[model samples]
Target: MEFKYSDNDQLSVSSTREKIQEEVFNAKCRVLTEIRECGQLCDVQIRVGEESFPTHRVILSASSPYFRAMFTNSQFVDPNQQVIQLEQVSADTIRSIIRYAYTQQCDISTENVESLLVAADYFNIVGLLSECCQFLASQLSAENCIGIEKFASWYACSELEQIAHNFFMENFVEIYRTSEEFLHLEPENLCRVIASDDLNVKSEEIAFDAIIHWVDFDPIGRTCYMAKLLGCLRLGLFSTYFFVEKVKEHRYVKDNTACRPLIIETLKFLCDLDRYADARSLGNFDISSCMLTPRMPHGILFVFGGWNVNSPTNIIETYDIRSDSWMSCQTAESDYRAYHGTCVLDGLIYIIGGFDGMEYFNSVICFDPVKQIWLEVAPMYSKRCYVSAVILGGHIYAMGGSDGHTRQSTAERYDKNRNQWSFIQPMHQQRSDASATILDGNIYICGGFDGVTILNSAEFYTPEIDQWTLITPMLTPRSGIRVLTYKNTIYAIGGFNGVIRLNTIERYNEKSKAWEPGPEMSTARSNFAIEILDDTIYAMGGFNGHSTISSVEYFDIDNEQWYGAADLNVRRSALSACVLKGLPNAKSYVPSRSRVPIMDASDTVHLKDT
Candidate 1:
């Protein structure tokens, strides 16, 4: 391609390409496989477990460094010798390995992957080894991750080992309860796992329970390790009642005199917290002790890029539920997006259509929480601000929003695999500043401003039918309302009602098909970021009629009332938020051990001298 300028200058603008398609590569591979099958120019016989596999020495030597050294170096092999015997691997595994060497394809399954990986490692076949490890890594579950991690590490498959280790720690509770291999873990590896800062447990009780179970599995050999494992827990985080009643009186602690000092330290820590409960303010207390350092959170709520005082903000913050604190994440300088739509899919956060204060955007940016990077993806077909988005059936639906000039009834569906967005059925009404959520295999979008008036109308879209149907209207007119589905029920919270901001809450009664009253927030807000974590709906920064505010609060099902939580670091409105679960590098998003502070003025609790 050539670019012509008005000044009579021209330049070539093109990308050079040199590549072969998969089918083309496979065609060449098929020739190698066919010749090997025909025994054409065969040079070697690999014998394993009562079976002999004929092969070409050149193919084998090219595919594996082990074979290369054996065939090339006189010190390793004799030129006259044609047969090599392998007793470590079965004939089936050897056959698969030979096939892969010829065709770059291997048949791997759960039953054979482990043994196949051993054969690949022994033979130094990097490609086959990688495929085997990848197969095992994909099959990692709580029940088998510990064994897989150990297996990968023993073979020096560093990438697979790291992934397995991350999964093992992130799902520690599940593995602890379900994995037989965890109970049989060696003391050193067990200590390493439990002591990692990456350990993910909502509470320290799970870690303590794991210790008891692992010790109980082998008391004779593990009794001495009781203190070592016990020391790894954040004992200070345990409730006073639970600590004194359960931990203090447990046989593991009572029977071992070596555990006496740890118990005393925890008691002192609890006593100090109780003593300072009333006297010390949140930030004044020293909370840098190892016993108080929080583990990696099971989930992290991200609040990023919002409309601030006079313009869009470039700020991004993470709320760590376990630590009950917010830490500002250091992100690359990016376009500040406001009124954006956010959806997390397959551990990646997608920031959809938004406004950058100057223009509405159809562009999309994907955030990799694991690698802490940003990338541009395919954009939407229509420019949108105040967009409402939801991920359903693995497809992201960007619903009605303003295109800067007017309210839009247009919608589109994004295919992550194709990096493309195609048209979807528009809503019944043009809506802006609406909220959308997934409930019962359908996408429900609630109240929003339709340019002329704030709307109380609500509707749902069924992907199977590709149509929208009107539902019951809200009890009050609302714009910028936050609607979410929790435990099969839909709750619509704070928003503006044209004349003023509203603090009221109403829930949709599905059977009755009407909006019922729920608890109201303390302060009225609109255009806020809301998400559910630990069974609580947390609402973050939003507009409070006159100005943007940093206040945050929550409403829990068990209490049936609203309660305040820690506020955000920035005051902003029109923000987008989502929670990412089971992130491998969650520790990077959260504050380190030294930076974690136990209390803040926004959220303080009293310890009743227990």
Candidate 2:
């Protein structure tokens, strides 16, 4: 504690000398810091074998520890001394060496990578040597792999030499995107880099850039790659109008010439978008058109009949929303029949009680569009045509059909699960060709000609009570009219009142138990197809009394009016209509709007294009 000033000065001098010595040593091992342009103030000399190389000549960050260490003892043998000179190696060559040494503690830069790699082979830095081998393998080129192999073999870097040989052997044909100082590889390594899964490039620009490289640069090799990218984009999930408008507003001009592959991929993506958009709406198929059979409470639209002058219309004709076209489906029916009762439940279409133009059919035919098969179920209690079949509480309620002799007050129930029919309480009046629809879990049967005359009385049947209750009468007595359900309300469109073909339209509210007039059809037609698709009521091909017309019309329930649609592909009534299927997760069932599988003629008729 009582040291003299002279002793303190001597101690300070010793400490300064030690600091100077430490700085000198550190500078020797890190002389490249001088190149950083004043970032480091240390002065040092770097020894490379017998020569000193100034690091200030290289352009690199002075703060980089790697840059500092690279120049400290960088060396290669000289011909004069039988040692290699690593300074003679090109930047491209050093890249391979540096990359190899990075994974190991060994220096793999041109000056040290090869020598350390050789040392690793002899000194058994197994993991270190292994990293060098992988580096050499990764950097192998078609023109240089053999030379690298030869060098590795001479230096006893057997693993490195083998790696180089294997790399070139497997990836000799790889195409690489190259720059003056960089190389982005193709094929295997490129796939691995782009598909690394750990890459965090979330920007669309970067992702699209990567995608373009794969798609445009090597289309044949990147088919699956582009497909996966498009799938991920799922461009269709975006609203079409919004996407199109955005693209137009941005004036995004694609590189058509250079981006042919990208353009193709984009087009495919757009197509998928349109397709799925339509498919999404199919599940909500509410209304399309309606038609009437010849019997009461049972008279529903017979949708399987239509005639085309240009082609034999054996297929089903459907209403197309986009084009307003009547798409003819020649395969709607397995057998030629009209005046049939059609009902939908659990995605299956059940056709019951129709005339095949030859005989009154009592057999219940169930058509499955998914399976493309038709099954026959138990016959009704009495053979009925113009019979009403309504689905309530998981059972089909069959009411009133004639046996070509007399209309009966008959009612029966068909259990879907059991595939059996049981007798139910009959109606009060003997009625046939009656329009019936289910409302509030009750069957409402209206207006049909009894055996003697056209009856105006309507009745409601309760499945729970197994009884029919007489309800209010319609404004007009009509038979062979079409009935539809929309938003908890029922609508009757077009009918014959014994003396005239009427275009009158009526709406019924179950709550009020009354019928009211709505918009009438443009054409006064009878025996027409009226259906519901897309929640709108469509009036399809029907007879106008003078000739069979191809006129088609649709009703706007919200607007409470009818508008013109595409005419039927053919001009025949007594036809039926149903929806089509779509891909999984698809919305609408229309094939035109969706990317549906291309169906052949045979398969075309079997599928329901919802």
Top candidate on TM-score is 1
Worst 10 residues of 1 by lDDT: 7-16
TM-score on alpha carbons, each prediction: 0.83, 0.48
List the pairs of residues colliding in candidate 1.
none
Separate clash counts for every candidate:
0, 61
Candidate 1 per-residue C-alpha lDDT over 1-610 given as tens digits, one digit per residue, 9 for 90 to 100: 1111122122111111223466678899999899989999899899986789889988988888988998888888888789988778788988998898888889899889888888899989989899998898899999889888888889999999999998898778778888898988999998988888778766777788888889999788888988888888888788777788889899878878989998998887787776654423545555677787887677888888898889999788989877777888875334598999999888888889899889899988887777667777788989999999999989989999999898998889998766679998889999999999888899999999899989999999999999999999999989989999998899999899988888999899888899998888988999999999756788998999999999988776776767777778889999988998877577777777676656422234322221
**Clashes (candidate 2):** 61
How far in Å is the alpha carbon of 101 misplaced in model 2?
54
Q: In model 1, what lDDT does residue 591 have? A: 78
Output the lDDT of residue 531, model 2.
69
lDDT of 2 at 341: 66
Error in Å for residue 475 of model 1: 6.7
